[model samples]
Target: MTTPTLGEFGRIARFFKPLAAGFPGARGLRDDAAVFGVPDGRELVVTTDAMVAGVHFFPDDAPADIAAKLMRSNLSDLAAMGAEPLAYTLVTALPRGLDESWLEGFAAGLGEEQRQFGIALAGGDSVSTSGPITLSVTAFGLVPTGRALPRWGGQPGDRVFVTGSIGDAALGLEVAYGRLDIPAQDTRAHLLRRMRRPDPRMGVGPRLIGLASGAMDVSDGLVADLGHLCEESGCAALLHADAVPLSEAARGAIDGDPVRLALAITGGDDYELLFTAPPSASDALATLAADCGVAITEIGELRPGTPGEVVVLDGAGAPLALVRRGWDHF
Candidate 1:
């Protein structure tokens, strides 16, 4: 049967209601807003992220593509809190006409992500816009009351860790800008997919929340985002240049320029999680990696002096400095 033509309101309701059905404590989606009570000893960890067309993504990008990214980006914030994915609220502004094709695909994408991340869609707002489309997603998770990971938790000598690969987005953006080209292989398509849609480290969050002294997602490039972490944790970092995992694709694009490599490291939009942990929790990181089946690389450690210094070291542990600035919004 053909699906019903859900206007803005009907579309949002039909998409989210069934997903939150199993979440009894999520208030059944009947009221204006859902109610969530943090478990007796757990604290609510919530984060919101907004992505605007032309700024966050290309205006011509697919609705589902934007939907998937907004979901993952917001969930990554929850990951930073080391919280269990509980629920989320989405706000979207669509441009021009409401076409069935885009709405169906967009709803499917959000629903698929909610199921994948084990979060419910509680509520949100939507409107037609004369400007480009914009999506804002607010995600919430639960963490042990006093133990939710904070950006200020890092201590000197605590080793830093990053999950999954980096620079895919930087290079992906390069592809978008015609600065680089992919090999046109199945693997390259996969890399493009990674650049388009990233799987947030949901399970890894709660695992590292208490142990990770300071944590944040690598949305902006490594240099820029890690600088935020260091500033929050009140420490400096000596990034092992060789230790920074550059995809073979990214390595090829660098043309052997360490400066470009450094730029990729410092560039934003990677969306991977960057965290610092004490040496004592090293074994736990290993176990967590095994359980989650995702890479958790220990790249560097916090230093006492010089906050925002993400030193890139060569294979022999020599320092590599770049004249170029990483990603900057301004």
Candidate 2:
């Protein structure tokens, strides 16, 4: 006999309503839309991200992991803007007759991240799709008025810094694809975990308000995202390849191979915060990093030149060539 499946409204009531229990604005998922107010002296910050099954992840990947990654990716955007988590709305598009267990696991994952990040589900729509499973999250955050960070705030002569090590997620993707041969099980696990669930720098974002002149998360490859900052700020950048931090796993994966190193920088999905600060703020930034317990490394400098021109220098200070800088949706 076939197991009974929860219909649309039944699924929402069973799996999603509890996720909104903490937020009154959600109206227990009975309302047509969410109603909320921003706190006094704070402005709302909003960001949305969408993921497709095959393109973003393996269709058969764990439902819980998929939820965590989706939530954290949106939270990473909020963190880049120096915002604190508030609430979020979700949209799920699944094929007809999908297993109810998938929804159960997905909602469980969302519930776990909600508590961990101090956010709540507001309201959302669930629909049946003819194609692959698709998920979208629109997250809301709040920041002090006039204090949200900007991508165009970088100035020439500012020092560029990144929170946490880079390249692990990129290598993790290779591991997921069975393209990289890593014999060490622990190292392999670390890479795979980083790729699956990214650690958003929420703790560091708010503290970067006056410290970082320009800030953004590294969702795209580090080099490409830095170039985006340069374009927005109308400046150029000089990146020191040797200064880029790498985790033990990433280091082992690269194993002194320049091609792999290039892949690491360009493969994307790191989700770390990349920001620029004036040289004068160096000491304060150092203190902030120590306080937040997240490693912040100075990897490069902004300069006056053609906008968006990123010159990467190797350990020996020679220009390095890359076939491509980052992932392109187009």
Candidate 3:
């Protein structure tokens, strides 16, 4: 069966224009570029994330899930910086012979998430490509001046914490690739959902403005990303694997498999926030987590050691050697 595709102008007029309808600065997406005003006493926070088919996601993945994942990935960065989402510009390099229905589904997904996150589609460009379906989203957000969280600033003795459970996305990728075995249908669904539609920790980020010392979303494996934070702060980290929170499904999959346990720690795509704060903020963090209805776990602490070093230990306190740190795109 032949697929229906739209011309560049036709696609913009039919699909993209409606997304910009109510945003005045977007100029209805008719102009070549968008214009907007920054709020008083607030700083604009900008972030960009791109996902390529067959690299970040499977080519045969659902178009809606792909769109949602792309948006959340960009939003997670803003969340790490303690910002509230405002708008985004999208750019897509679509493959030839793509179905028009795919565009509809993708736009629908984007619209739904935009409404949920209180953001709008400002403007963007779409072009055809012979390669995979690649998507890049440049998201805009706002934070108070001089208050945005940095990747550094954590001191020795600060508590290292993470929001939500880890390893689900990595396991979800395993489930999607048919590399892992799961007999329960519900468990499979949970893992797949975590992979396709990760929550961006939007609510928790705003509340962390005066609390967290340093923060970054866990995109690369937890260990690798935390190592980045450590390097930026000129310190080291001691991560307790036993203290790393995991979804019930993740625990079930690992059971007693040492390899799966390692993957859970090092595998990436867990969009949860990895942050550090002083012990004085523990109660406040707990209160914030409760208010936001997100789980918060103290996995370890930043310490004085070789900068950029991340040491992971087992329950018995023995150092565990990790073969791979996390996902790296060359």
Candidate 1 wrong stretches, greater than 4 Å: 1-8, 13-16, 24-29, 252-260
What's model 2's overall lDDT?
Answer: 0.93
Give the per-residue lDDT digits (tens) of candidate 2, residues 191-302: 9999989999999999999999999999889999999999999999999988999999898878757689898888788999999999999999889989999999999999
Can you write out model 1's per-residue Cα lDDT over 229-309, one digit (the tens) per residue? 888777788888677776776776665455567667866777788998899998989999999998899988889877776
Model 1 worst lDDT window (10 residues): 321-330
**TM-score for each candidate, following the candidate numbering:** 0.90, 0.98, 0.98
For candidate 3, write residues 1-330 as lDDT tens digits.
446666899899888888877678899987889999998999999999999999888888888899899999999999999999999999999987888888889998888888888888899999989999999999999999999999898999999999999999999989988999899999999999999999899999988888999999999999999999999999999999999999999999989576898999899999999999999999999899899999999999999999889999999999989998888853
Q: What is the C-alpha lDDT of each candidate?
A: 0.78, 0.93, 0.92
What residue pairs clash in candidate 1, if any at all?
82-205, 219-269, 220-268, 220-269, 221-267, 221-268, 223-266, 241-313
Higher-scoring candidate on lDDT, 1 or 3: 3
Per-residue lDDT value at 80 in model 2: 98
lDDT of 3 at 104: 87
